[model samples]
Target: MFVDTSKEVRDPNVSAIAALDEPTRRRLYDHVVRRPSPVSRDEAAAALGLARQTAAFHLDRLADESLLDVVFERRSGRSGPGAGRPAKLYRRSTKQVAVNLPDRRYELAGRLLAQAVEESDATGAPVREVLHRKAQELGTHLGEQNKTEVFDLLERYGFEPRCEGDAIVLANCPFHALAREHTETVCGMNLHLLRGVLNGLDEAGLEARLAPSPGRCCVRLQPAA
Candidate 1:
């Protein structure tokens, strides 16, 4: 499964997957994806042996969830001022979706590890050092992409932040399993990552620090002292 960073992304992905759960809709979707070009409602309906209205409803639902892209074009060979109304067409969206329980981000970790290995081999640097640096860079990049408040950003990444007195405490560790097995390495990397986030966002109110607690994240972003 792919890591979706926010409810906005994950909810629609869930809806799209759910929509495909219906047998007819699944068949129609399968057919549409197999085609090289965008398909019209009529084509989808006929191909799937479904009524036009049924096909339209399911197609529109898929489009709503962004599983399908909607396009309009004059399918018929026409020209000039007398060209007819454009036909509405459906095509598989380029968007990729992955939803995971407990919010695992193995793919992100894998990418960082892979890049670290490649760079270390090329430049003869230590793999662990390169990996940590790359992970920090990725965290900074993620923070730079945040268009919302820090709270929203934390929530989006599944940090499960909650206010505790003057500081914010994270209730969940997004990298639970990795941290459990490799405590020092993972926790240090996580700390640097969040520190990079704060740096990238120019957030001066809080500082990411290591303050391991049970049933919660090992790192906390506390009010700067």
Candidate 2:
């Protein structure tokens, strides 16, 4: 059966995080990333006082999760067809991983804020207006990319979406800290983002509304009048 690569791409962070759960793996990971050059399994084992086999196992696991990158080289400074198979070297992957428990996406907010500032500087538009517009555009684009149910799309983006009768209750704010620190600004941005999502989805039966609740997201999608 054909597999979904988009889902696969989004999943490595979870695997990478889980790979670090083992004490030995964590130590090896720390050690490898600290080195300026790639590390061999033997070198990692000796540095961390682990058996070569143990080090190799964890290293391979890290590579499997894309936490580490693998390369081959002749460690003896010799090159020839007769020189035998090159040693496998491991290095820190260029990939970045961020797994927020409540699924906060501060980075997205930061980017939008930065862009708004730059555009405001260039065109003398109000930064707040630029930010809200950009956020709405992004939300609309996100919704347009999906043919799945709106709730599924929200869940995929870590909204922790659930239903309360006819309304959709988002249980987690993906911008939790920002929302707390700058409630008015962030909540307004979020409200517009959800509105854009609804518009892009052409969801005539639902409407995005700001209805702050304790222990849940400040925005709710309710049935249209």
Candidate 3:
């Protein structure tokens, strides 16, 4: 069954996206980004037929959310005492924001795979071996960084962990599509990753192993016997 993991954390990307829900703010953002260069409140106000105050408010809000970057420059190209204060201008920020329901981390998987291939070519080790090692290292680092209970830690990474007797079943796989197409390789990486997590966390009561089911993640955490 699907689990709602949104309540577990407040993602900044979601907040940034929510900031655009306001009609006027969204309009101001669109106008500013479409410009060839930084746009001043006056220019944005005139172009969008909005009041200067309205444009300024929305532009500032966008800047607050990192949706737009703020800059100050003298429009007259003057740099003397008589030039007056620099005008505030807005531009699209370099920050990228993305939010996906059920949470996917294809970038992490891609990076792990790429590192494996590169390291294998350099050391002549098998690609799969390198991949499993790297994945485990990363998982260990994640576990070390987040010193929480295993279930909470799993949930934080988008694994919808649920109890089934003494075992924890994952309702979702963050690398769903990749796992479907390349089961052995991806699932093997996942298994080793979780194993590292347990090792890093010093949790000896549970062990991560491949127990592939029809609709869930291939790896399951069962009570260590």
Candidate maximizing lDDT: 3
lDDT of each: 0.83, 0.88, 0.91
Please give the RMSD to the true structure for each candidate, in Å: 4.8, 3.7, 3.2
Q: Evaluate residue 36 in candidate 2 and report its C-alpha lDDT on the 0 to 100 scale.
A: 96
Model 1, 109: alpha-carbon shift in Å? 2.0
- Least accurate 10 contiguous residues by lDDT in model 2: 1-10
Q: How well is each residue in 57-146 modelled by candidate 1, as lDDT tens digits?
A: 999988888888999999777966879899999999999877777676667666877998999999999988988798788777877776
Question: lDDT tens digits, residues 79-150, model 3?
Answer: 999999999999999999998788788888999999999999999999999999999998888878777789
Best first by TM-score, ranked? 3, 2, 1
- Predicted candidate 2 versus true structure: per-residue lDDT over 83-105, tens digit per residue: 87899999999989878786888
The lDDT ranking, best first, is 3, 2, 1
The clash numbers for all candidates, in the given order, read: 1, 0, 0
Worst lDDT window (10 residues) for model 3?
1-10
CA deviation > 4 Å runs, candidate 3: 1-8
TM-score of 2: 0.85
Candidate 2 regions with alpha-carbon error over 4 angstroms:
1-11, 78-84
Model 2 clash pairs?
Answer: none
